[model samples]
Target: MGRWGPRLITLGVVIALVYPTLGDPPRDGFPLSTYPMFAVDRGPVTRVTTAVGRDADSDRVLLSPHLLAGTDEPIMAVRTARTAVSDGRSAEWCREVADRVARGPARVDGVETIEVVTETHEAAATLTSDAPPVSVALHATCPVSRR
Candidate 1:
């Protein structure tokens, strides 16, 4: 019975961990989870996020997606960049991004500098060039690694 008790507890823990995978809402904290960040609906409002570079005159220059390490997951990519900016590691992140881009297939010979910008737009807003961004915030900027 003593040996059986430990095995039963182990089985119970396994079952609890796998229960969420069976249609339950993903969650984190107490026990463990897959960090259900997007488990709930976020509604129609969405913010378009991107990273770009600016010339010496501050003119915006669209950077290649390679800046995000060419990740297949856009949300994860943006979150990582934003976290880096918020954590005050934007300079290191910028260097890593620039290095990745230079080594990527985008043919960006070099990146002089970069910044992470986020623009909020209503999902139903007219997708026109002149619609104007509802809001634009500059998160971080850093000079790219020349190396």
Candidate 2:
């Protein structure tokens, strides 16, 4: 009986672990879950609000999150960009990004203008290919001085 006690408890716990899966439309519970987030239908393409730098030679360069929001966190920069556009303050945000670029890495040295824009792209292609964006919605533009 003593030896069987632990085995029975183990068996019960295992059963409980998998019991949630037996439900027809599995509902989330104490630990394991079928949370609604998983059932969400997000598509392949996504529109992202961001900042871009235009070089003197007509080339567009994507700026980093640091230039956008003073942080390395991408989500924070996205929020900052989106908020600026939605609030009609994109010009101000664009200047901030331009300022950051002027003081940032050498790769942005030739950049003469900063643009706040929303770009749409296929998530998979963006990650795995050199494909161009599907669309770009420009919101604001500002100059970056050599200072």
Candidate 3:
């Protein structure tokens, strides 16, 4: 009976640890996967500015230029959008970029507004021009545990 008791406790502990991981959401839907790093083949310019704002509201705009290696032109840009709720600021930015890409090139006279909000920051912007399709490449920052 003593040996059985220890075995049961070990089993209980294992189940407790596994339960949380089993309930975790899929990685594909995660923000990290959604916002992938892009590789550009431009000139010496390794950084480009990006803006985010809403289609109707222009007062609250966010402009951020991320430092990227390997390109002169702004080959890739990240667009982050924030709402009053939801904790996924990075994912929202990626989603907005994807939506803009799907909508095709912006008109010379028209404006593409973007808005970003997070626990840390809020940004908005109105972008113009016919930008190319931004390609996103996903890389895992953390390694998977085998144990």
Q: Which stretches of candidate 2 lie over 4 Å from their true place?
A: 1-40
Candidate 1 wrongly placed segments (more than 4 Å): 1-39, 55-66, 126-130, 145-147
Provide the lDDT at 47 for model 2.
86
Per-residue lDDT of model 2, residues 15-124, tens digit only: 88888777997777878755655676779998899899999996989888898899999989999999999999999999899989999999889889998899999878
Q: Which is the leading candidate under TM-score?
A: 2
TM-score for each of the candidates = 0.57, 0.68, 0.21
Q: For candidate 1, which ten residues in a row score worst on lDDT?
A: 102-111
Q: Sorted on lDDT, highest at the top, how do the candidates line up?
A: 2, 1, 3
User: Mind giving the per-residue lDDT tens digits that candidate 1 earns over 48-101?
Assistant: 556776655766666654467466676677777777767877666776776665
Ranking by TM-score: 2, 1, 3
